[model samples]
Target chain A: MKYVDEFRDPVLAKSLIKQINILVEQIDFAKERPIQLMEFCGGHTHTIFRYGIEQLLPKCIELVHGPGCPVCVLPMGRVDDCVSLAERPEVIFTTFGDAMRVPGSKKSLLQAKADGADVRMVYSPLDALQLAHKYKDREVIFFALGFETTMPSTALTVLQAEADGLENFSLFCNHITTVPTIKAILDSPGMQLDGFVAPGHVSMVVGEQPFHFVCEKYKKPIVITGFEPLDILQSIWLLIKQIAEKRCIVENQYARVVQPDGNFPGLDAISRVFELREFFEWRGLGSIDHSGVRMKDDYARFDAERKFPVPNVRIADPKSCQCGEVLKGVIKPWQCKVFGSQCTPETPMGALMVSSEGACAAYYNFGNLPELMALKAEREKEEALS
Target chain B: MTASVPGMRKRSGVLRAETINMSHGGGGKAMRDLIEDVFIGAFDNNELSMLEDQARIELSTLTALGDRLALTTDSYVVDPIFFNGGDIGKLAVCGTVNDLAVGGAVPLYLTCGMIIEEGLSVADLRIIVASMKAAADAAGVKIVTGDTKVVDRGAADKVFINTAGVGVISKAHKISAHNAKPGDVVLINGYIGDHGAAIVGARGDLAIENDIQSDCQPLNKLIQSLLQACPNVHCMRDATRGGVGSVLNEFAVSSGVCFKLRETSIPVRTEVRGMCEILGLDPLYLANEGKVVVVLPKADAEAALAAMKSNQYGVNSAIIGEVTDAPTDTVILQTSFGGERIVDMLVGDQLPRIC
Candidate 1:
């Protein structure tokens, strides 16, 4: 609570909001459109919504929820692969609770579990290893999902498994790097231009250097910000000042937790265990080259994909879902043809709707509650008239 | 509880088994002896002491209490049966009691049925049974009838409890989720997320455990005080499995109204909040065993809050929010930062967001 309490101080939040308002007014570019700032991590998206940071900020600044949620970005094919491996008789599947709901081509892991599979939710990779130790006869496979924020831990877990000579344990690595995904978003055509808020936890591992291209080449101010109410406000203020002063640089607003040089040992651990795949699939966004990481050759003995021999099929995104546009900031979630009318949190048709962190799902679940009430009433009235 | 069984005659055939086996549920002498020694010996009421296949009560007795009967049932399969504050037996009774109480009823009797796993220690079973007796006495209800079964070792968890309860609702009392109107006040009893944090922390695998305990208790006494002070209370519900968020969502959709809850007004202990932060869970969505959501008209809000404050369970009761008519079917939270967002139900269980 010591470190967490200070970051959520309402007093500090108010002062930061005031400073942000002042900076936004000075940087009022043409006053016709608002300044677009994107936070590239789902952790920040969750904090922004949980604390209502977007509502506290001035109307001219908009925070675009980026493609940082690993579950949101994972394609249906990968989930199917996980399910195929999990469905085997002698295998025990383990995954984070968040990924259990992501829909596959056939079904999600939760569905597989309900269908009499041995899928389980574990908080960490180490918990999965413990299950392997407990059940010596069964094969334990961990669905290692997330970006660099979780890469070091999974890498360390695999190392621990090898050191303990645990051969029954393996990893279904879906860990992705943030650099390629960010660059893909930047290169996507027709995105309204503004600064960015880089992911805080990912920066702690990969360092500030991975985000320099967005500022140096794209000439957009990017701040490596923490996921707290006050931290978000201060980072917005920093981005606004940079835009007003015509400066493009990567600043660390969360200097307390993140380092400019990053965690060296964590990066080293990750490199030792993982190697880049030629092409790894994304849910909304199509497959990107060198975007995902797989188990290294040295760690091949601990790879679930190789150990289990799953039917790794490729599945395409649903044509009706506009998640691709939403991820790249091409359109708002409500602009999609099937946002609430056809797609919902309960029966999600798109990958974005599967997880709360996805931009479309967040807007559908959290955005415009009062307005949605009116919308529901109008629809009911229309139904009555019909 | 002084374990002196002075009332019920002791069955001379007390079996000698340290742990239960399949024969204990065989409907033979072993089964009866286990029930008499464990349940009937602990409860020791005239109705249960009879040991009849079914409990028989006069119809006039129920008719005299109220015009209608409220019957409710709940099943308890909580892991780590022995938690910091209470066990599964206590939860089994409190859950069914609260279910009946929230319907504007005075709970009268309960029936408990347990499915225990083989190889479970008999000592642990006795402790759990004793706990149920204490809870039933506190709620002023009788555990009139019960049953038990033993399954193979891997077939069931240590123990699973199912409770069915009957209560009488007076003709004058009217409580429903659809009864809430605009300008109504929302109130909650005590701190939220104690039960959820306690269970998750008690798991001990997360390594984020603290001194948090479950807030599991019977709410019949608290409900009685609220109805006495403000008979026009719109709605009452215990925030159970999905916590306050799930119950509030049901209220909004059922009544076709919206709610604006003040986040700061919702009382939660510091430790629970810290544990939630560590696990990336929202306390509003966490489970609470001893908390209830009370909604009443603005005119009766003050009296209801005063009555709740006088009771043991509702001592920390506070008015947390207000009902609105515009945002129908939406529950919004006025965040501590003076901003608002919709509090939507999680698609599945609440999972942590990766940074």
Candidate 2:
């Protein structure tokens, strides 16, 4: 726990909290509106909720959970298409466990498995490849989905398959890039975020270069951050300090893991295997140009989408759901029309309610009880006064 | 193999096949010999030696102990049947005994039923049965009646065990999940997540090398001692499949109260916490075999904790949390970071995220 315990140190966290409190008091304050700082990684959202960091922060600072969970942003029809591929007689479908419960138009992969589809949960692409090797006659299709942090591994796995000349293995690539997606959210007509805590691992592969656009164009201070409590607190301090001095730059708070110039071999493997698609449909936000990747034409033989036939349809999000608004920080998850009523973790209608990394799920599962109770009391008091 | 003692029941000849066949469960002589040599041979009590379909118990003896009968059942299907500390057989017995023990019962008799795959090794079956016998003896409960069935080779994993237990609950020991009121202190017996971390590592899925072993043991004697020291204990539960988080949630929801857990006070081994961190899982939801969550009033907390600390299973016992009146039907954890968040029941199976 050397690497982990050091980052979660409560002593260090309290010291950072005191500094944050002092910093906030010095900055100009608006009573009506809180300064919005978005953590642009689902992993960070999970850390925030798991450690209850939001409660410990000053009232002026609000952390908006961003759209970083690959499973949470996966569109419904793509899941249905995955199920369609999984149902084929000779096909063996494998995916990460977090993706298994995501709802397709008709059913989830877990439900499809109960209905006799050969769907399995795998930890890595290599496990799917091993399955392909084990079942020679069966077609093994990996449902690959993630950001740049995970993209390199999938690329390396495909390269491994090629080196070994494995024919039966292929990836159903739905890999999306976070930079363009974050750009789309920033451009949307909603709450204007003051700063960003950039995804740490994604920056480890793509480097800090891609995030320069946010700093230069949007003038938003972006700190590449880690998931530990102290790491997050320290990153927030960096962001606040930048705002106080009127400077916006791409800085790396997680310098222990991410470099200014990312790993070259990882980027090379990713570029060699994948190319950006014209457009990719997301669950909450609609379709974005060049937000997703597919296997290069040269690597088509190792692509599951080309190897198998599927419906490949697009299903619209529910009318009442406000996942888009939640994604853009326009609305809190509980303010959404269908949050607990129609959209729950058990029978989720929108993508946000489906994964632990999603804002709605995190709020529902681990929201600060005292804060919620206080909010409820305030609302009741206001109604009584009115 | 010869019988161990003189005038013992006759022993069947050594098993013919290394693995079992369909004939072993066909309800014929092969099935009889398998049951007699494997189960009854190891579980050699007078009640089982009678070879009857059902066990006969004296009503007077049952009534003399308690006014109510606590009947409970549990099924065991743990993978990697043999782990570092225990096997599925031991888990099956401990699970049932603890279920009754937490209900303030004096566990008396147990009925075992097994569903085994056709290709399971006969020697493995004997070893499992031997483990079950040892656990039953430790709990002072007799395995009186049993049944067995073998399925096709691919139908079952290796073996699955189901145990139904009957115990006498005293009239004065009134215990329930809903009985906990505000001001009640929550206590746990020993370190959490030993069994869960042990099983996850033993599954060999992560290829992690850890020396953690399963904490699979019966808690009947320890619980009986706690009640002897403090009889007004409001609620007690075995934190098994869903761990202490789910158990606390059930208590909160049932009692219309809240539980405030201190992360610093909750007992978890550093290695177990490390394993959970690696898998992106919370140790609160991991399964435990030899763990109990007890809630009692402030006055009895010290006595009960002292009584628990003296027992072999309760040496690491600590007051982890307290029942609260606010935020009805919720459980909150005061994180070691000095921040607080609600701890809700886990939805779906807890799967290790691949990020």
Residue pairs clashing, model 1 = none
Tell me the spans in candidate 1 whose CA falls farther than 4 Å from its real position. A28-30, A370-386, B1-13
Q: Which ten residues in a row have the lowest lDDT in candidate 1 chain A?
A: A367-376
Q: lDDT tens digits, residues A100-212, model 1? A: 88888889999999999999988889999999999999999999989999999999999999999998999999999899988888888887769899889999999999889
For residue B350, model 2's alpha carbon misses the true position, in angstroms, by: 1.2
- DockQ of each candidate relative to the true complex: 0.58, 0.74
Compare the candidates by lDDT and give the number of the best one: 2
Colliding pairs, model 2:
none
Candidate 2 CAPRI-style tier: medium
Candidate 1 chain B least-lDDT 10 residues: B6-15
| Stretches of model 2 off by over 4 angstroms after superposition | A29-32, A374-386, B1-15
- Total residue pair clashes for candidate 1: 0
Model 1 per-residue lDDT tens digits across residues B1-355 = 3466644445344757899999999998888788888888888898998879999888898999889999999999999999999999999999999999999999999999999999999999989999999999999999999999999988999999999999999887899999889999999998999999999878887877687889999999999989999999898899998899989999999999998899989999999888788777899899999999999999998999999999999899999999999677788998877678999875667776554
- For residues A1-386, write the lDDT of model 2, one tens digit per residue: 68877888898889999998888776775256687999978889999999999988998998888889899999999999999999999999999999999998899999999999999988888888889889999999999999999999999999999998889999999999988898898888865899999999999998899999999998999999988888899999999988877899999998988988998999999999999999999988999889999999999999988988889999998789888888888888877877766888999999999889999999989986665676557667978999
